[model samples]
Target: MFKIDKRYAKANNQKTIRFTDDLYMQLETIAKYEKISFNELVLQCCRYALENMEPLEKE
Candidate 1:
């Protein structure tokens, strides 16, 4: 079994996601440049998107 970080599991319900090589490489580069773990970079992206998302229209 894989060892998961308890903090990540608790905060985000810990799910796995797959990315294309191009996208993954891009994120990897950005993460390295930012000097953060890949997981931390992903988490930051999720938080930013959620915070900036526009509301849906009413039916």
Candidate 2:
């Protein structure tokens, strides 16, 4: 099962990023349901993607 680590959820740094209005709404909804901050959810998504993605191949 997927779980958000409370320790990891604590922000240590900050960066600016932009999201489309639709995407922002979706993320906000999920974060509200999960009772976590929007920042935490986004961090989890980014970490998950980086950890599970395969490397790209060169032509």
Candidate 3:
């Protein structure tokens, strides 16, 4: 019997996407070089962007 991990199951339920082979390879390379999973890399990027990205000021 195969029991799905809860975290994976939750992630699987989310609506999003399939990366192309080239992008996957690049993510893998970056992950390996940084000793982090590709998912972690993407999450870190998202967090950083959300924290630092500023919207335009309305005049």
Candidate 4:
């Protein structure tokens, strides 16, 4: 099950990413509703995606 934890450790690294305006608004809205920072939501999403991703078939 995918879950969001409110507590997070301080990040030691930083990254720059770009998002479409529509996607940005959607994420921002969700973060507000979830009472978490947009960054946290994005991090959780990325982590979940990686953990649950299907392995690619050998070509």
Candidate 5:
């Protein structure tokens, strides 16, 4: 059986997404540059964005 990361499984709720061609190409290039799989590159981006994303404060 395939293994799952405990941290990723914690975010198992279903979600929607759509990526632009430019974004896909950029990620693919980043994956090649880093010598990591495309999926791993995307995952790292998600993790990084989540960590850095700040919610807007309510007025």
Candidate 6:
């Protein structure tokens, strides 16, 4: 399930990442389908991944 955050559009921490064209296209397609900005999609993904990694890191 995906939820939209209205504040995600605001500029907070500005950063740049380089991605392969294929990966960028895939992420863009998913972001479009989810009706969220690409930046929001990446932020959500990074947060999700980091949260899930915490317990594993403890081990």
Better structure of 1 and 4 per TM-score: 4
Estimate, for each residue in 1-59, the C-alpha lDDT of model 2 and write its tens digit: 45675445778898999999999999999989888889988998888888878987899
| Clash pairs detected, candidate 6 | none
Residue 43 CA displacement from its true place in model 4, Å: 0.4
For model 5 the local lDDT of residue 54 reads: 94
TM-score of each: 0.70, 0.79, 0.51, 0.81, 0.59, 0.72
* Tens digits of lDDT, candidate 6, 1-59: 44555466765888888999999999999889888889988887776677666565445
Best-to-worst ranking by TM-score: 4, 2, 6, 1, 5, 3
- Rate residue 11 of model 3 by lDDT: 29
Query: In what order do the candidates fall by lDDT, top score first?
Result: 4, 2, 6, 1, 5, 3
The prediction achieving the highest lDDT against the true structure is 4
User: Model 2 off-target regions past 4 Å?
Assistant: 1-3, 56-59
Q: State in Å the error of residue 35, model 5.
A: 0.4
Candidate 2: clashing residue pairs, number = 0
User: Cα miss at 22, model 2 (Å)?
Assistant: 0.8
| Number of clashing pairs per prediction, in order | 0, 0, 0, 0, 0, 0
Q: Judging by lDDT, tell me the better candidate of 2 and 6.
A: 2
lDDT of 4 by residue, 1-59 (tens): 98987755355579999999999999999999999999888888888899999988898
lDDT of each model, Cα atoms only? 0.70, 0.85, 0.60, 0.86, 0.65, 0.79
Estimate the lDDT of model 1.
0.70
What are the clashing pairs of model 3? none
For model 3, give the 10-residue run with minimal summed lDDT: 1-10
TM-score quality measure for candidate 6: 0.72
Candidate 4 at residue 57, lDDT? 88
Error (Å) of candidate 6 at residue 51 is 0.6
